[model samples]
Target: MGLLLLLPIVFVSNALVPTQRMTPWLRDLTTWNPISAVTAAARELLGNPNPAASIDAWPMQHPVHATPIWSSDY
Candidate 1:
């Protein structure tokens, strides 16, 4: 669809453009739709240096069943 093609265009254009001028449009785009175009832009900007790398190697807190206890549950 035409709209699908626009997503990548919007993402690349926003990423290549100066942040100042692009900020408004980027913000509006992200707020208007959390997925697709806006999401792509965000990933291009904030994603790790090696975007191709898998997230399994990334540092993150462990097992879902394990919860840290700072104090007694009471």
Candidate 2:
């Protein structure tokens, strides 16, 4: 039941469609998705390839700062 509920969240968190490729509304959703923040933080820490890093979004531009902000919020 919990997994079912969480499935859509996972899908919308930019795993399926890169935020850059999503429609504007979806892109906005993905931008603030906690998963995106976590992923961005991980990529920054691990030096992994993050395709979205090139985008001009605040989270993408300052992932290290965004992660803590997101974490404290929820």
What TM-score do all the candidates reach, one by one? 0.21, 0.76
Worst 10 residues of 1 by lDDT: 57-66
lDDT of each: 0.34, 0.79
Show where candidate 1 strays beyond 4 Å: 1-22, 36-74
Cα lDDT tens digits, model 1, 1-74, are 99997677556432344333446556445323323223333454565332212222111111111112211275
The numbered model that scores best in lDDT is 2
Give per-residue lDDT, candidate 2, residue 33.
80
In Å, residue 51's CA in model 2 sits off its true spot by 0.9
lDDT of 2 by residue, 1-74 (tens): 99998788788785556677678888888887877877877877898878778778898778888878877945
Worst 10 residues of 2 by lDDT: 12-21
Root-mean-square deviation of every model: 13.3, 2.1
What C-alpha root-mean-square deviation, in Å, does candidate 1 show against the real structure? 13.3
